[model samples]
Target: MKSYIISENRDSFLGMKLAGIQGIYVRDTADIEKAFKGALKNPEIGIIYLTEKAYLKIEDLVLESKRKNLFPLITVIPDRYGYERQQGVITQYIKESVGL
Candidate 1:
């Protein structure tokens, strides 16, 4: 089994490739969804890493797969520019966790 990434950032995709992880650099939401589905369908894929942008485009689908406890863990990751919610990201996480 191997890990795959669905990224919208070319730099991040290349960097991950250098680390020996294969991935697809998606240009649009359609491409992101397609790549995500393909990754999910692959039994050889052990982990599916999605850049923030790509994950957001298909958040519901990913969540559904997670709830179903499907194979190949799905994870959301930041891009080359880092997290989109730079300001208050920690705060947001805490708030969500605390239900505040």
Candidate 2:
């Protein structure tokens, strides 16, 4: 399966493209929802990378997808500005699951 990215900025989209991942550039809730739905429907796409800003706009949908399916794992990635200093929710989940 392939990986896809959905980002809110041109720089982030370009960066992921450089890494050989196809992506969508989103500017609003509508774009985010559209890209996300399309990616989920694609059987070849098994993972989705979303920029932090983009994910925030559709956190509920992302989480719901995670709860309902195993493929096309939705991951929130840092933007061109870089990741937040604090621990992220996924990191916390990993730590708890692994007893870290």
Candidate 3:
């Protein structure tokens, strides 16, 4: 399994690409579903890094992956625009799942 990088801007993705990331996905518009689907298709993609805002938007896809027990790890990151802590529900669920 390989790794993948997902970002909303091309500049946001360059660092990973330069580091020899085999797969990179960038969403021009605000379509999180499209980005999620694109990354999910690749069997080699073992990890997905998402900008925080984008994570909130397309988190349903992340949930589906969890339901199916897919192992591609999903991590949230801040984009150039900055970070937003708007996902209280998901955070609670994650905490509960981890027995925290």
Top candidate (lDDT): 2
Residue 74 miss distance in model 3 (angstroms): 1.3
Candidate 1 similarity to native, TM-score? 0.82
Taking the candidates one at a time, how many backbone clashes does each contain? 0, 0, 0
Where model 1 places Cα greater than 4 Å from the true spot, the runs are 86-100
Q: Residues 1-100, candidate 1, lDDT per residue (tens digit)?
A: 9999999989989999999999999888888988988888888999999888887888777777776654777777788788986888778545533434
lDDT of 2: 0.84
lDDT of 2 by residue, 1-100 (tens): 8999999989999989999999899899999999999999999998899998998899778877877787767787788787664557677646533434
Q: Pick the candidate with the highest TM-score.
A: 2
Error of 1 at 35 (Å): 0.7
Q: TM-scores of all models?
A: 0.82, 0.85, 0.67
Error of 3 at 80 (Å): 3.3
lDDT per residue (tens digit) for residues 1-100 in model 3: 7777677656667767788765445454455667677777877788878766666677766666766754677776677666666568577658534435
Q: For candidate 1, what is the lDDT? A: 0.82
> Where's the lowest-lDDT run of ten residues in candidate 3?
22-31
TM-score of 2: 0.85
Winner on lDDT (2 vs 3): 2
Clashes of 2: 0
Error of 2 at 73 (Å): 1.5
